[model samples]
Target: MEQKREISDEQRFCEMRATVEDCNRFACALFQQLSAQNSGNLFFSPASISTALAMTLAGARGETAQEMHNALQLTQEGAQLHAAFQRLLSETRTGGVELDVANQLWGKTGYHFLAPFLETIRDCYDGGLQLVDFQEEPAAAADQINEWVSRATHGKITELVSPMSFHELTRLILVNAIYFKGAWEDEFEPERTRDQTFYLAGDQQTSVPMMHQTGSFGYFENETLQVLELPYRKRNYVPQFVENEDGSVGLMHTEVPGGGGDFSMCILLPRERDGLNDLEKEIDSATLQTWLTMRHQEVIVSLPRFQLELEYELNTPLESLGMERAFQPSSADFYGMTDNPEGLYIDAVLHKTFVDINERGTEAAAVTGVVWAAGCAQEPEPPKVFCADHPFLFLIRDRQTGWIYFMGRFNQPEHQAD
Candidate 1:
């Protein structure tokens, strides 16, 4: 029986791992769709979006649930899926960084929802249901929900929900907010930052402030792309190796604690300055996972200091990913959320994100609302060069779980002339 219990625990972990894999695919699909629409800068938080949708999924049933499951490529079903979410959310702990993930459900004050739905959210997602007057005071309800999101994100995302999006039929709104701030393990000296020429698409160029650093980082490269992992500061130290007198390297297990982290910002720079489009075109889950593998080695990194804030309405993009019925009120089926025969359909999905990457590190916040609707690299013999002087792809993710929190592309650089 003990062996069986261990096996059961392992299987549950596998299920959770599968969920992360599915989220990787979902991120790729979303980036492909959104990138195609916008030729400039693009950024979004897949974790935030997935978490909010997962909350809604707790109350979804029938085809609605299956569509979401398929679109997300979720492996676990029913209770297993929620349990996976619970563990995943709990496992995102790191000591030296400020990482916060918050979820909440705002339901109509008078609307009657199934107890199981609310309980599942509270238990698995740590999201408690908050009653609001969406029926009579839609604007107030939006403000209340927005305030929660803003607080969760440390004001990085203040107005995620617009009052105009609320309607009489909008009975529930699910929200997920994530905020992360981590300094680079080896921070760039502000004095080293200088104006550099960043090549943009269409043979354009812009002067931007680029930070420079020379340190051992996770690095990888191929004939087509160069990948660099800039880790954030975390609690405790990571294993490092030093060359011995006998020309051998040995692991230094004991070091100053709190010198490394489990979170990193991975930048994928194309071999050719203008190869971003082709690189992006070839992105898929398998190829992406391949690119993320890296070895720790000495690297010369040059990264631009940029800030971006963007909003997206994900209805069409999600529909394109085979989640069609959820947006269609007539065809949508969310019977598990409430006893009402006229079930809830995903009315709108609004997402807002803010990221500031400078010499210090990265401070990012993303808030995703389902509106209920219900709705790095390796090492080497010699130091490698990873200069983001042109269009490139970037991902902020957990080094341990391979879960992408935020992903984006930097195409046109904002002028930061010193």
Candidate 2:
């Protein structure tokens, strides 16, 4: 008889949680950095940024890699980290939600990227490679990269780079794009949506379209904030803990064995309308994980129907997080990416994000390009009218894996500046 072997569910969950926990820590740090620079409707994707950085880290060496590990709080080593991410990518894809992740490497002609680096990303993360002549045609190169990102994000992040952002010296660009669309397990009724007064910072106010619903949702409260969870519809995908081709611990989707939490949106509403900043300051990994302990309660929910598009240049924020080495032209060591040792260092890190929340559900996308470019819900009540009428922190996550795909605050709604 053939010997029986198996990967325990605990082992796979452990690895998946480890990676996502790292992502959570990185997100909190990045959020603090980005929050310091602005007081508007702030939004960005830590998952997208980290995925792009992981690609960069794959080609990093010496102190550069160490700096990234420290900054990213990545505890796993090269191969192990990649394996964890691969497992995570596979596990996330096997759920009820529509979650798509894509990675692409674009190198300028005449430059040779090292084969080992290429192999690592391809095998571990399934990255696709493309060659573009950034040296000879910077504009065309930018357009090509932007087009790929737009498509990957389902046109939500319509573009990822501008002509001014890329130049002839650019040797390579690594891009990561994530797209997600999921409906609330219990959705809002459109007829109930009405224009309501929303208090803004500094005692300002605006009439915004606020959607209302009363339902049993995961709920928690503290002196400073109220937490509500609006779980996404999860009917289709059941997870099967299976071994991948490499015998790596991963999951496969099959007929229902057991599963839930395909996707969910968690909203953190500050007690005081302007206390969002304070509430944010209190968030760390423990707090977020603790907040997820929310119990089901009949709460009244009032969330604005909003759509937002945001673009940001992340060089300063990343450096603030102690990832300075990768951006320095002289000290940056991404030699593993190319034969020309001095040829490629990150030129910039650009990011774009989009979200549209309505009565039906939620649609969001994010694209992060390391211009080697380089580098929700709920509630009921009073059933509790948990009105997000002021600034608030929110997250959309894969509850099973603790993967936060989107996170941000809505202080005051604003039109896209671009």
Each model's TM-score?
0.91, 0.88
Report, for every candidate in turn, its global Cα lDDT versus the true structure.
0.84, 0.80
lDDT of 2: 0.80
Highest TM-score, which number?
Answer: 1
Worst 10 residues of 1 by lDDT: 1-10
The residue-level lDDT of candidate 1 at 277 comes to 89
User: How many steric clashes does model 2 contain?
Assistant: 10
On residues 177-234, what C-alpha lDDT tens digit does candidate 2 reach at each position?
9998877777788888888888887868887888999887888998888999988776
Error of 2 at 207 (Å): 0.5
Off by over 4 Å in 1: 1-7, 237-259, 373-380, 416-418
Candidate 1 lDDT tens digits, 96-129: 6789999888888777899888888888888888
